[model samples]
Target: MALLARRVRPDDWKPIGVDALEANAMKVVVSTDNRSVIAGPGAGKTELLAQRAAYLLQTGMAPPPRRILAISFKRDAATNLAARVRQRCHRSHAGRLDSMTFDAFAKGLVDRFGQALPERWRPRPDYELMFPNDTAFRGFLFQDVGTPPKAIGSYADLQAISIKTFERSLLVGSPLPVMGWPDPTVGQWAADRFWQSSLHEGKKTFLSFSMIGRLAELLLRVNPIAREALRLTYSHLFMDEFQDTTQIQYDLVRTIFLGTDAVITAVGDNKQQIMRWAMAMDDPFSAFDADFSGKRTPLYNNYRSSPELVRIQHVLAQALDARAVEPVSKTAATIAGESCAIWDFSSPEIEAQRLARFVAAEMKAHALGPRDFVLLVRQKAVDYAAVLEPAFRAAGIPLRNEAGTVGAVMLQELLAEEASELLVKVLRLAMTKRAGRHWTECQEALGALRGISPEDEAAQAIFARELDAEATQLSADHPEPPASKADARTIVDDVLGFVGRERLIAVHPAYAQGGWFEKVVEAAAVHLHGSSAGAADWTEALDTYEGLYAIPLMTIHKSKGLEYHSVIFVGLDDGAWWSFAGDQVEATAGFFVAFTRAKQRVVFTYCAKRGARTKIATLYGLLSKAGVQTIQIA
Candidate 1:
């Protein structure tokens, strides 16, 4: 059924939840020209995109059957942007916004139009997505003899055959010169070989996200019909976190929408380009301008951070780029005392213990919960977890290492995955005692899963009754919350049995591919086992599962686009941030990102015993210049 368009007057359309947009923001939002919005941290990038989407939809710029496509780097960011637009616009208008991550978008293209791909590049209908390690690549490159090919110089040369190498060579359909490779030809040959091996498994095909992207790009390029169809379907495009876009992704966007009438609005801060290691374009903003002839607009309002914190962030930002403009803070300090501080400790153990104690005391003093605080590291959050987790446990504070892996998946990624979300939602529904928004949402989801329409009140009523009976049975079977790993597994099984795994897979077809549903369930159970400890009861345990009552520990990369009342940066010495010396620009940008995540307080800890401070002396000096206090703990 085609959706009916709701036309709204341009004069009548207004920003939701705000009086009016900033002058520059308003121009960007209403402008029909392709635009590059370079915004610093806390500049309301996502909100601006959401508002712009609402503006376009409400004004009937993208009418019925013509949709707006919004692409974000992260799944959560995509979901948030879609949710905001849904809240601001009418149901029919909001339905036209297709918000998805770059990976998901590319995969969708491949999934729908894969048959258009040449046989050599085509994947099976049920291809398994694989994230191969360096070791696997090395084995594939130099099978068994432990001898390097003439093209491969040494072990160091093998490092050149990374995902970026594939993106540039195999994905782009030709070999491009790679920085560290001996020859582009050799790199292309290796990438092609890897792809062939990945896709040709007997009775089974394997594909990586990069492979899927390449296939998608190929499908669009080779099949003019598919390309034209996409161009005609979307009249407006939104690119969130544009600075992190990779070369292949940029090319994919150009392949589909470059010559079309679609207006592309890219929003990002170059200072937050932390994905360079993953082959993000070096000068994405300039490339976007050159390719799309985009009008550049810079936003200066800091809506997420306090004034003091914003000031501190500017100091670091200026250190990264001498000409950087300071963003004005729209928020005032709500918490009293120092907004930025540096803690110096003599040893790692002392640092961990003192930091734990400090967080515990601060939570009690400020009447804050575990969610109010977060710990950020430069990289390798698991290593930091090994040091900090015990101390936090000793302090009776639960610390969740979001960057750590559950099974083969990262904890944060697993929690955000569809299967995991489904399990959590079902568990929450089962434990519900009263009817409210949560219950209503859960019932709606269940009804949708069962193919029952909301318009059919009689069908909905019957399904709701059956759902209630199932929930009752689940509750009776497990009267108490999960107390152990076994209990968690049992609860998962019970929930799956109650809902019927087959029905869930039928509703969410993606779950049927690659055993993804089972894998997520396994990961969720493992995570529940570790996180449910010390939980008072079912509700408390569920709270922990839902990322409540626990401090979040993640890398600075993972901490992007998120905020907390207070942030603690651990292991600021050279050893933890070894890459800082080689790429100070990105490191400083990352530090700026971490600094801006705190609304009221930012704490930096340096342990003398962990590593020498010689490499990060400049960082320490920058903090000093920012007027941040240095507290030496005895």
Candidate 2:
């Protein structure tokens, strides 16, 4: 039935201010004065936000919203919210709430404000480079790092790295540029730096995202007409995932509503800021607690997940003592507790094989499709990071690696190598503002790699320095005749480099000389330049399997915004150092994040043996060995 047609209980105590609405939603909304919030896993925070938005508009509490800005963390989150708002608008006449990414906001600001710039001071085409597809990014990574990361997984890895570099290089300590209302001060800094750094020496060709954000901001500030237009539009700005909102993006939202009659109702789940790359800041308050100390209350309850899943998460929360978030209030009706499963293996090498068997069995018993579930992992570069990633890929199962979303599509080859994704992660973080170095290092490498496909030996030579060895090793192991793989790498490098060169034109300067994105891309590209022809086309030759194999292999960070029916953790074996597990608090928290993705079940798979010849040490076993035992299923 259509959601609109679904029975709307007037007294429905569903999650409102909090993920668990209960009857306290209206109370929290009233208490907070205007804005309300919801927090927690499976808390239905989005639903609550939607309900509150609908009601505020329906009751004439909010001024007519010409364009209600609904910002979200991920593309999925944005789309999800827009869908809900569209659905809810049927009952209310709240004009329209335009949904967009914070980056998009910054871009919009520049687009609106660019009128002030000299005719020549214009943005290049496709100012925004999409989040690379899992496969495409993987291909780029292989071409970059020469060897793949042991097992690091997730797009966040690259995003986090990129964000860190951006933040670190902000030596002036200026705020990032937002979209709608660009700050002139930030805009000037951006434009001046971009011309000096990126275009200087003609070293780097591609622009970093930080540069783009600042330029967009500059455009907004320079154009007086643009700022006035933004003021005229989007009177009331409601940003979702406000806690995760970056500084620049936040600035734009705040600027547009400055001194306006528009009421800004910032609603979001503060506890879910996992985007370290974007530098996700702590939320001011969860829906349960009032952000305003004077009038604070909480909506503490859950509307999703079974009691089993919720309770386990609760136990972890208590044990970990996570201070950033409030307690997860369980409201699911109790059912039989679903035990967390652990898989024992002799070695990390064997973990993949065993997990494959386990996953295959689950597929058979559950009649699951490739899209039905996923395999969660820690890092994308480390060995055994997501061991099951290759196992599933090699086995012909349609396994969704970390990078593919409807709005965000990656290349197909990225799914082949385990550490391939981290290449992108590392590069994103290390991106420099200077276009020349970034351009010279990255675009040149990508160009050479791209050449391999078109059989351009000269281009292949450029990136061969970096990837030649690894590519040759892979080719040698696989033993391909005449080095056909060499040509493939060139093609991939060319495509990515081509794209990077275009993107390079827009990044802010100052970051060009030294940043993760620049470093990783440069390092990988350089590596390829030195390698033999066989390795030049490594990106195209990476192995792949097709099927809905091990649910989906992803980083724990990626698991935060998703849910599954059952999740199994593998390679949690051996000592902390040897096993392919997240040993640090962040990694452990990532484990917890992965474990909590399930709505009904969770499975922890780790090897039992400590020092088997090939077994990797698992931090989980060591940590649990202190008092808690690693519960093995078989």
Candidate 3:
């Protein structure tokens, strides 16, 4: 069967690529039962996505009553595609294209069918949705689950697994238990209660991110009218970055559109699915054969990287897993011929400094700016703030750390000051009577304020040397001269008012963008048991705001779906890249994703000795076996 556009002529559409694979994939969009395009890095997947939207619109395949919906993993990605469709497609046909992220689409469904939602999740006047940060979630989990194991000290892992299990159970309509729990019944009970409590705590009602996908899937599965309305609402669905799709996300799509007239186009490269930590499975199309019986297309010609770099990527991928059989031929021009190397260093700090100097020199030689280079890490460890930041500044290199974890961690460090701890204590005492923390938490903050640790006494002597005698005497060890609620409010107002006017707001102009003030308010809210409010504010400050234009230093996960002219990947040691778990397949996949992000040059850096041994990193050995030549710097 040949697919044809309904209302537009052949001249109206522009060719996406000259390659036969890309053209065949586009035509299979309408002619086949369903299509799954496995596109590699720089394989023009974005162009194919845009052209497919234009084709469906131009062909009249998606009329006004039956619109086409395009969903992506990130908001910026969806916005980019929407912009492309508007510019490339005809003005009249562009209106039928609905482009948004999965979360946005789920929110729309919830708003449309509020009554059909589960009773626990039905919409209310004061209902608010919140995607809480790690700090807030950990605080809430501590309160619910009590103090965690001393060895663990945090229930973040448990909370994450519970949430994943909770959402998946809602999708499949079965009570699936989280593994490793001693008693599944008790674990399930606590998870259910936590889920309910997270929705409504006191007068504030906050919605978690997982609930959106779960409830939307539930509504579509249970409500006949809602199902039919959705089935008739969209004619075709195009999902990009399908490899990063989670189980709940996949289940939701399958629940809503299966056995319907919707044409689905799921496009992603299996090798690039590096979000396994977030519960994204290996096979994105695992259910396609059973559900849609889709036809699979692979695009092997990479139009993004140089030929030299492309060969290296192939070796890295194959070293991980030979079954990962998507070899790509480079179709892009080489900017700097064969600019790839592996640098060796004795210490991590020296390695960072050398990277900055190298980047500065590269910019001068290649006519590039700071933005043209990227320094990538496997994880955002303490060195990102301690070593990399100062190293770049010392070299007069304009660099910005794009990893939000670093910003959040730095904020916590700033708040750890003695003067800041006093302000937090005052806030905790003031909020005690309302929606605030427990009395024990208030007492703990007061103790830290009254009796500073031996490590903090030096900073306290400088910042809060002139403390009130009355406040200093009210320590957790000795609670004396108790103050009333009015006194506490006055103390909070005085302390915060003083810090806001004197310390935080009066920071040097150069350091104002460091988010000191935001962190102060957030730390106060967290200590005072108003973390919900703090979570919203802190998340907005980190996620909503963009850093200055400079070289981006981020983790490999953050660098996914993004490319640069020059890339440097540091920390290739065994513990950082390949753990003791012996999962080289997953490790190599991460390296492959990192290597493919460079358009021209790539540099790998590793320390020869982690602590004492002079053993090289296992990744270096793997690459050597793969026949990769490294210009090592001793």
Judging by TM-score against the true structure, name the best candidate: 1
Each candidate structure's TM-score, on Cα atoms with residue i matched to residue i, is 0.88, 0.57, 0.67
Q: What is the per-residue lDDT of model 2 for residues 185-293, given as tens digits with 9 covering 90 to 100?
A: 2323333343343323243333444445655655556665676777776545556665566655544544555556655556554444455344444444442133222
RMSD, every candidate, angstroms: 4.4, 16.1, 16.7
Instruction: Give the range where candidate 3 is weakest over 10 consecutive residues by summed lDDT.
Output: 538-547
The best-first sequence of candidates by TM-score reads: 1, 3, 2
Which pairs, if any, clash in model 3?
Answer: 5-59, 6-59
Give the TM-score (vs. native) of candidate 2.
0.57
Q: Count the backbone clashes (under 3 Å) in each candidate.
A: 0, 130, 2
**Candidate 3 lDDT tens digits, 348-446:** 788878888888887888788777788888875446557787888888875665554322333323333334455544433433234134233433333
lDDT of 3: 0.61
Q: Can you rank all candidates by lDDT, best first?
A: 1, 3, 2
